[model samples]
Target: MNKKVMSIAAMVAGFGPSAYSLADSQHDEAIERGQAHYLLFCANCHGVDADGNGPLVELLKVTPTNLTTLRSSGSEATVAERVLQAVDGRHAVGESAERKMPVFSDNLEISTVIEIAAYLDSIQK
Candidate 1:
């Protein structure tokens, strides 16, 4: 192919939509819900900014995980898995040991938990 044709093809390839892009609208809506849920139920311990420095941190025997660093090493899928497990009470961590974090399975819908996981994953360091 000519250089110009090759360049055009490259541009088109880059612009092609993937499955994730097709779900962007849904993901955006989910993120909004997750943000609201986090603020209302998780902020007191996870912190409003998700930095694990909430006012109640000092009272707890175990420190909350610094959520901002949640994805420092793991893939997004791994992070999502961990978040789901934690919410479902299947994956307790240091903070969970103190029983400070409640099992959200009864409170949050599965979709909401997944949404929260997506939002948290989006903000990873």
Candidate 2:
């Protein structure tokens, strides 16, 4: 087929919508994966709603930061970096020198941590 005809066919095939659908699919996948990680690793402290009111809160010396307001409450970049480090078994963003949160660096992949962060950021209140 001629180049012009091929281009026209591509456009007529809902290529534009297909591309958009793919992007939406990817976003949805990311959110799902992220939510899984959050539920497994974070919900215990951050709560299912990321509200810092997890069931385990009464047992802890320090309160968990509300994950949903990480950006509105403070710097988004700072929050993201802190989350990345916390998940990687490094510094705890808001923890004391005697950190209490479980480190998942060995258990979770970097990509998974990133997905969780993206999900958390997207749900910011």
The C-alpha lDDT values of all candidates are 0.65, 0.67
- Candidate 2 deviant stretches above 4 angstroms: 1-22, 76-79, 92-98
Q: Give TM per candidate.
A: 0.72, 0.70
Q: Write the per-residue lDDT of candidate 1 for residues 1-125, one digit (tens) a residue.
A: 23532443343233223435766676667778878887887778889889998888988877777777876755343556666666666554555354456688788776676667667766768
In model 1, where do residues sit more than 4 Å from their true spots? 1-18, 73-77, 92-100
Following a full C-alpha superposition, what root-mean-square deviation does model 1 have from the true structure? 11.9
Count of steric clashes across candidates, in order:
0, 0
- Supply the TM-score for candidate 2: 0.70
Q: Candidate 2, which ten residues in sequence have the lowest lDDT sum?
A: 8-17
Clashes of 2: 0
Worst 10 residues of 1 by lDDT: 8-17
Q: Counting only residues 3 or more apart in sequence or on different chains, how many pairs clash (N, Cα, C under 3 Å) in candidate 1?
A: 0
Residue 69 error, candidate 1, Å: 1.3
